[model samples]
Target: MARMPSFLKPPKKIAKRQLELRAQLWPDLNEGDLWSRHTHDGFSTIPSTMALIMSIMDDLSKNKPVSSTYLELWNRSFDEGFATLAKAREIAFHSGFSSERAERTWKDRLKILHNLEFINLQSGASGPASYALILNPYKVIQKHHERKTRGMREDKYNALVARAIELGDISLRPADPSPPPTPMAPPAAPFTFPLPAGSAVPPSPAAVPSAPVPPTGVPTSESSKV
Candidate 1:
């Protein structure tokens, strides 16, 4: 095993950075659960598998958003084949894992993920089969709905609409809330005649002006004070 090149030295304060990154990446998914299941306490498989998936997920997040109005995605695929397996093996080996364990993890762990429907699988004719799932379409729907409910941007909203249409069967429209009953105007008070043209509203009797009355006693019989 040749020594790692000195020029490729680890960064200063990398431990804190690594911890911060890990916290950001796996922030108490559900108290104890991380986003990925294989990352549980009993991780006997090659650690590289989880690392690879996490890296893929990060890449997917950066690239293929549910709907990208601002970005042109640099889409990448995790194909199932010799090259991918070899890469996993290499990561595991570099992480102080035995080659046999790396190979076993490459086979066994990914099968678990596939069985759980975490990855989409496609059969290949005379070629290596492939599997993928960066962001689950259902999860994407949930996330987009949350965004819309919380007020997403117009461009993003339009992109999501386009993507929803592209997806065909997946409905992005919220359930019609049976619109607020059209607010019937209380039958318009059942008027028999049309209102008069100007100031048709009659003043209340109390609001009408009254004539001024003479003083109670002093002007009762005032015939010009004769």
Candidate 2:
């Protein structure tokens, strides 16, 4: 039996997955709700790149778990969308650029995607080179949509609270009516004797004077003051 050479050994299983993804298309994908966020995030600046990426998305539709897309970037033939290179050249002409320029502009947006960590450029041995699509834009845009939805919900909840306060619907119900406030006890009058209808009352008694203390161990005359 002949042993297989190292070069003849098949690449890893993930390599096959990448090859498969390069051939599929996602039919039910929706981005209508995400367009506003796309505009907000300024992904609209690179029309050429946008076109190229969307074409890649159409071809790469497997939508694996986000972890599967960490291959750095993805490559595509310039003719991914068009039937042939001639047609791509025609479209490029209509877009006011040569086929090479349009291709260059689209690939050059790798600079924009670099900071975003979306894709990284790679060179090929021959033919057109490709880049690895680090993250799925669809997934990122989906997260943006999720955040936007949460924000809207929070705003709605806040508005409801504000309206409740405005209409004075405070405390859910009316709060039991507060018991009646506990009746206060009346203050007492100063201690005094009352007079009868025909009898007069006695005057208040005067305080008695205290006697002075005598001098201790002193011989005193009767005339000396103590």
Q: Pick the candidate with the highest TM-score.
A: 1
**Each prediction's TM-score versus the true structure:** 0.23, 0.20
Candidate 1 backbone collisions, by pair = none
Backbone clashes in candidate 2 total 8
The digit string of per-residue lDDT tens for model 2 on 43-96 reads 212222333334333232322111112211222222122112223333334433
Q: The CA-based lDDT of model 1 is what?
A: 0.41
Error of 2 at 165 (Å): 32
| lDDT (Cα) of model 2 | 0.40
Error of 2 at 215 (Å): 81
